[model samples]
Target chain A: MTTTSARAAAADVVIRTAGLIKDYRSARRGRTTGHVRALDGLDLEVRRGEVFGFLGPNGAGKSTTIRILLDQLRPTAGYAEVLGATPAAGGPAVRARIGYLPGELAMQGRETAGDLLEHLVRLRGGRGSGRIGPLAERFGLDLTKPIRSLSKGNKQKVGVIQAFLHAPELLILDEPTSGLDPLLQQEFLAMVREATADGATVFMSSHVLSEVEIIAERVAIVREGRIVDLDDVATLRHHAGQQVALRFADPIRADEFAEIPGVEDVEVTDHTVRCLLRGEPDALLKAAAAHHVVRWVAEDRELEDLFLDFYRVPAGELHAEAEEVVVHGR
Target chain B: MAVDTAARTPTPAPADRNGARADGTRLPVARWVLREQRRSLTLWAISLAAITAMYLAFYPSMATDEMEAVMAGLPEALMSGMGWDRIATGSGYLESTIYGLLAPALLLVFGIAAGARLLAGHEEDGSLELEGTAPVSRRQLLLERFAALTFGLFVLCAALGVATLVLAPALGMEVTSGNILAATLGLWLFVLAMATVSFAVGAATGRRALALGVGAGLAVFAYMADTIGEMMAGGDWLSTISPFGWYLGGDPLTQGVDGAGYALLAGLVVVALLAGLLRFERRDLGV
Candidate 1:
């Protein structure tokens, strides 16, 4: 079922991008002033029936990639294919099979949630109009109440439901759980599960790693508009490697633990043996037992640290980094 | 599975009735766009009707012998500049005041202001994304919004026309009903041409303020050129180029319909719309 196509495994690849580049040109009075490379030679491939988490900090070009995928923004260079077709050429036919939740939802309409949902459903060819009631009920959304009157959480609920209403083949959610309460976040995960169970491919972007870490089987970590790492969620966590520090009762020779398998950077400073350990630490633990270790502190390497290492903004340039995002004009 | 079954809220009122009706039309966005503005459109129509009625009711008192003598004493150039040159006759009085200045001004306001907001307003507030990403193509979406804007203009124009035709005779104003129809049609075409331009600008830029500025800006420039063009070196040329000149210069009230002028206005609408869509298709939205 998966034959490798010219560029990708076309049969199984739900979303694919190759060297996609987007440059934001800041202009004044129709003259280009400067440019920021929002997406720098980004390549991505999302397979069918998988929740692919796009992990990156702010200004890592997460939203830019989502917009390009949705056809809201065009790439300055390269190509993107969603649901077996290039979005630009396919247009509505391609869009019809996809549902997207924008990171920024406009909650300025005067119509009630019910009215807005009904109106949009009709525009989407009225396919999923019947599900609106059940979805609203599940979310505790007062459908009759006007959208402007709703609280932030409730407004986000409206947005969440709308994205799932059509039940398309692919769902691209940008910061889907940003405004939800913990309870609602669970319900949202359930929704994602339901969508996936129905054979939908999910591509969700999040700066917060834990939320995505729970559901995303695989993830791509981006930094400065380029992917620094891409791997299975469990594999990435394993690759992070543990940080271990053992304080011993007796003076210890650093050479004793140096020969232990799966341990490196062994250091002995005043009977405190500290080192970076990978895989099972059983061998190192056995070696440390010989030194009459008084205090053993071994911390499993948190993927959060690794995520931050890959995505953290270099300090002293926060102002400029933020400005690039602002000047990027979304 | 965090499906909180115990907290099941009441389901939304069946399928939305308005939605059902909208789907039947096969032009849901267009129908929905018009339906959502029903209250505002009604208010605009009522206000237009009331204004026309109020203006027409004053014609009898304004056409007395003393008023004619006063009009005669006024300088001809001054009277012409004020759009009140033919104020003595029944048709002339309507032409100079009601047909010439008042109705056209109100229509332009309704057309340009409403037109500019038709697309850009939705776009600026961010709701345009709902339609923009729906199953419909961008081209279909633009055409639907444009159609709704055009139809809304008709409602406003009809309100003014109905008021004039029904109330003019009751007030002893000897205005020809046929000429009234011609003038109303002429006014619709003129205002529509301008509104379409405003619409096209908004569609292309997705900036309501800029779109509105261009719309209002064009109206001001056209009105000035039309109002003062007669005294300028090449006056006849202004009458041909300016929309206001096509509208008030030909004086639809006394002269009846100008077929060529109406055609030009219609043609301008098509041209402006196509130009706007070209940019709309290429540019990024809500930038």
Candidate 2:
């Protein structure tokens, strides 16, 4: 069920789905059974120009949602709208204005990257040939090789180029950074940001929390075909704190370390120790100074912690415990 | 990193409609089908050319004196295997030879090509998934593919027709332009029927080897059944079920043109085509 509040009304949304569901009937057993409920009453809305990160673990509805938006898969029930028109009615024009990188991109083996790009461009009603070179150059892709000869990562690069070649208004990428190295990942995020700046909206799905945390303006985390959390990353991070590590020059006894206010749990191995701390780090640092402060590292809990938290894995069961610490702002 | 200082840039060129025809001219589904078949098309064309040449090379002796030997002395086992015994010499020896050999070869090639296109080729390369996402509907995809298969059969038939026209004079065989054309068309219909069967098999199994194997097996079975039924029953009634039976009954060598038989073959082709299309449309891709 979708709750249309005042903020959603003001955003001029480009894509929205209400109570979306998809069921797959298995063919093998001759008996009509084992329906995979890939998507279940998913309620999602993406506003214009915002880079919405759709995060979920494997078997969640991330790819399913993107497929529904592209009109590749029919929903068992519920309604989906893209750019103000129903996905069913959107047809080629809707496809023309949207760039999509499918979760699995296995292209025809015989065609060269240039030929494939040319064909896709023509399908999008563009001057297909010349754009292939420019797109390949921008993505650092080689267009001369046959599709079969290229590795999976290179093939993904070709898919990326073809998707971006048409310069569609909305880019829906599923696990876009999987094949990219760290440098390329940064470049790709830059490209996405540039596209967003030009009024194009990017709705990306990924399981990588760190990558999502880097550029996502708002994120929706899906678990078991349901949206578990949807909010700004900074806000989620503030509520979920950072992970901290500290090392003392002298060996600190376990009982002595446990007595500190903010140090929730402490593990001592010989002269080194690790602690999970909540709130500010100044108080913990002061406590550690009584022994000998050799090296100190204090950082907030990562997005993974917040993601795991939403799964209802109790705080006691979590390996790390949270503690409150007092820090004075200089 | 700071936001792009360029503030705003003009919307990138409005999405290109790549290469889909403008104003929706809708090229006959044949073009798209051929586009998918691009890899193996040249090799298929070359093989068809070679088969036509071979058929032409042996037409002389096979049509005349040797024809009498084939009728009187050929082993029953070989005769049954080749579907040769059922063709009466009264229908003319040349028709018997052409009907016995060329018809089966055409049907086999058609089935093989259909199997490759519908099953192994698409599944192996993953274009099957890509096609599932394309704007083209499932029925449209099948129709276009069938159209290409029909066109390929036409080219093969034309090659055989040209070969027959050239071989008739050297062999002193009676071969009218009308008879050769009618027989070629009849042969094409037989191949089309087989292709349609393969199309259905491919859709049902979604496996290349299974579709090709089952289609070829079905054609051979239909031929053998018709031939055996004819030898024992001594009537054309039972042969009506087999495409091979229809083509032979058309008598491309002697009758010049069996319009009624050819018409029946065309009817069967249409029926098979409709059945295949319906099955394909209903079945899911990438299954």
| C-alpha lDDT values of all predictions | 0.80, 0.67
Give the runs in model 1 whose Cα sits over 4 Å from its true position. A1-10, A250-290, A312-330, B1-25, B231-234
The DockQ of each candidate is 0.40, 0.23
* Residues B1-287 of candidate 1: C-alpha lDDT, one tens digit per residue: 33433222213424575467454648888888888789988998999899888877778888788987888788776677675556666677776666677777887887887778878888888878767877787788888888988898889889999998898778767778888888888888888888888999998888788788888888887778776776565677876788777766666777788877888888989998998888888777665
Q: List the residue pairs that clash in candidate 1.
A: none
Where is model 2 chain A poorest over a 10-residue stretch in terms of lDDT?
A: A321-330
Candidate 2 wrongly placed segments (more than 4 Å): A1-11, A27-33, A127-129, A245-297, A305-330, B1-39, B63-70, B73-99, B110-116, B119-125, B200-214, B234-237, B256-284
Task: Please give the RMSD to the true structure for each candidate, in Å.
Answer: 6.0, 5.8
What interface RMSD do all candidates show, one decimal each?
Answer: 5.6, 5.7
The structural similarity of chain B in model 1 to the true chain B, as TM-score, is: 0.88
